[model samples]
Target: MRKRILGALFSYSVIGLITLGLIEGILQLVQLQSIRSIEIARKLYQLSSREEYLGRYCHSYIWKSNFIQAYGQHREDFLSSSGLHVPHKTRGWTTKPNVTVEVGEKQYTTNNRGHRSQKDYQEDERKYSVLIVGDSYTFGSDADDSYAWTNLLQQKDERLQVINLAVGGYGIDQMYVTLKEEIDSYNPDLVMVAYISDDVFRLKYDFRDYKKPTLQVKGGNLEIENTPIGGIEETHQEIKAELQKEDIAILKLDDLLFNLKISCRYPPYSLFSKVMGQMQLLAWEESAQFLAVYLASGAEVEEKSHESRGEEVFQRWAEENEIETLNTRPYFLQGSGYQGGHYQQAEATIVSDTVYDKIMDLESWKKFVETNR
Candidate 1:
């Protein structure tokens, strides 16, 4: 009887261990399937390659172009220092410059001359030179000088000599200051301030790097802050700290896998896209909020957003001042709302392609330039 009882206990123990193993196998299979569900055409990064991304993680630069890294900010795969992306060839007419153009303190090399590359553009004073001002879009990141909307605008109408005064990571106050300094040098015919919504909160983040005159509103009038440049150093230090955090990749396997799928997967919009957007909104609240706040401040603070931060300040100023600005939010939609400030990732970007192209269209660019001029 004793022998039989001992044998029964051993048998039960073996079955329990087998059950646990089976459970673990089932869970791993479910996770694998969950990952496999992504279906989309993979895209390649236009500038950097995957091997470059792996190298970048180990602390190395990927592309030779300065604009490539600047544009890659915010969105990981869309603009990451990492090179895990489908190659996107630069559009024709947007080739590397055979010449260089200087804006602010930075110099950009451009292939402005087809086969004939000029050394530099010394503002031909006689021509009606119109400089288009904004942020990265105006500068044309991850793209050549010609690919910039300003360049595309120039191609549409030969009458306009459009110079892009857009810089990556610049806010409205900075832009306004840049304009104040540059206008004297370039003497643009007209300034079409494409004030992005994201420019609003930059003061709170990189307030130190902000050297422009502080702007204030008193009874519907705009006032420059006139704050000393001495105040900006502290803000620059904070910004540097934030920039340093980019190197830390302390994320979970599932989190990393999901992002990898989204980064590699093009056309994030699909039957399952809404679900993905929901997840992203949950994960990226800080980014979204920052965009909302800065975009509002980018415009003249005299105005207020009806919960729409940027529109209240800048849009109102544009309408009242006739800045020839184009706000693409009405024709566009993204979860909470669609305005130029929010960063579109994965499927949201794919979904917004039409709106983006419409804004980027030769005809549309021509219209914006013509109106602003």
Candidate 2:
């Protein structure tokens, strides 16, 4: 009897170990398949930082970059690069003018596809004839740096060399200063400002927010403030200012349990989101607004309004100074083909399900910029 019991225990132990091993193996396999199934950039990201381009990040079978702003995204998801709005990198507007060369410590390289490229960072080119500046949209959030507006701008005018000095998360204030400092060095024919609506206005809230009017006519000379971002007086204190709008709707633990019980009884969008995610064949162009708007959080909806307001001021400033200002939003918003929609690693939106149209039209914007700018 004792021998039989001992034998039984040994058999059980062996089976358990095998079971655990199999589970781990299966998990790893699933992870691998998931990585493979999802599209990734074909290149490897370099180590050094490029001051003017989108940073990149990569892993085996997986790659990511912040070059494309996933519309209506929060500070969630995998961060493979120094993404916009993170506030950790770039030292945020406090650095000195002209002397502030990009350091190697924190820059990454990202391609157009949400994939991180593979390459070591190195200062390749410096001498450029024309420099363009703006926010993520101007910075080419969804596409590779080469596909960005500035890159397109470069192709259009062969005689005029171009530099995309647009950084992510920057408002007009940074644009004003960065241009003033770099303009003399590059010294070109035109100062083209590829202003993104979302980036032009200086919200009384954000730190880098400051707007300069297009024209201040003093004795008939168009006077541009173009001040270094520091001199402006701040109105609303950021840290203490209470949020007036948007209900975040945080749930308590008990409420979560009750909701979970209901979810088990019924079903939720989680399953639908998964199914839609699996079927890559969905035509984003057919139903761009439906998907994106449905998933849009209230805060995101509000941002659209902000972008419009900011664009007005920025355009005025650019025009009065004889600086060329271009708006690329409408072109991207009205895309008609597949190339116009479907972006990856976008800022995870509340309206993630139906945002294919916006993704497809990115090229149209780039193309227009290339031709016009």
Candidate 3:
């Protein structure tokens, strides 16, 4: 009787294993994978009464680390002693000069002083110069250096020289500071401040990894915070420490499958989500300052209107200072062919054409260039 019972137990165990394998196979065939399972589990967990335990383990840092390790890159390669960018005393970071960064099969080289252009500029050059300041769009983050709007404009009119002092992830405050610092040296006949609506939202975050400074309005003045953050290594270490106590080890199989499927996967809209999250975090402080500045100017501050408010304030300041500015807000509103986020070749062409039109329309700009040249 004991022998028979032991044999029966072994048979039942084998049957259970086979059934489990069949269910997993069925799940795979039906396009329901581990990620879907996890999503469903998360929803069920949320519906439960055990709030504290769920909250503690829900957003595991280990999971985020594993996700990045699977889908993201080690930023150390792009930033370190041998990296593209170097620490700047005033700008927080700037690209290393005369370095050729290979992206895919193509290569992009920076000119002397680290600007992303083939031609180098001298203060004494006998050319009609236009100084451009803004963010990634102006820096040609998407299109090639040859295809960048600034480059297109240069191609269209060889007589006009364009100096782009734009950097990726720059806010309006940084543009203002860059123009103030570089305009005298470059001696550009016309200055263009190119901006997108997102620049207004960027004013809120310190963006520690980039070591970017932020602005806060105090006593009706824009105060610049030039301090750098701890850096990316410190952030990684902090995250690792937070997840050390949890049993959140990544499996080899998961990592392999993630890499296999990564090409088809869409990157998360983390930046937009981050902006929204940070907006909630900074609403009170920014709103108070926004209210004070607007009220002082005899302008009414409508509730939930600070995004446009921030932009309008800067626009007014630029106008008052007699600065030439080009706003790309309307173009973005109309939409472009760019995938993910940055502008494509066609969009860059549009920008180049629009800017050319604006400059030609400005009689003072035309006079300055013609007279100076």
Best model number under TM-score? 3
lDDT of 2: 0.33
Comparing candidate 2 with candidate 3, which one achieves the higher TM-score?
Answer: 3
* Highest-lDDT candidate: 3
Clashes of each: 28, 34, 0
Q: Which pairs of residues collide in model 3?
A: none
The predicted structure with the larger TM-score, 1 or 3, is 3
| lDDT (tens digit, per residue) of candidate 3 on 1-373 | 9999999999999999898666545434333234445765444333321222334323222233553353336434224523566655455556677777766654555778677677776564466677777677777775677777778887887667788777766765566556556655655556666665556545544442244655555564455685543445554464456445533233322222333343233222332233223322232222210000111001111222334544565455545443334554454445533443565577677678778777776654557667865
Could you tell me the lDDT of residue 163 within candidate 1?
63
Models sorted by lDDT, best on top: 3, 1, 2
lDDT of each: 0.38, 0.33, 0.53
Candidate 2: regions farther than 4 A off:
1-128, 206-307, 311-325, 329-334, 337-373
Q: Model 1: runs farther than 4 Å from truth?
A: 1-119, 205-307, 318-324, 330-373
1-373 per-residue lDDT for model 2 (tens digits): 9999999999999999898666445433433433445333111111111211112211110111221122124333222133332222222332111221112432334332211222221222332233455555545456553344444444443443445566654544455445544554544333444343333223111233222222133563323443322221121122122222211223222222333332343212232222222211122222111111111112323334434434444344434443212343333343322232212223222112122223224443344346655
- Candidate 2 residue 103 C-alpha distance from true site, Å: 19
Candidate 1, lDDT over the whole model: 0.38
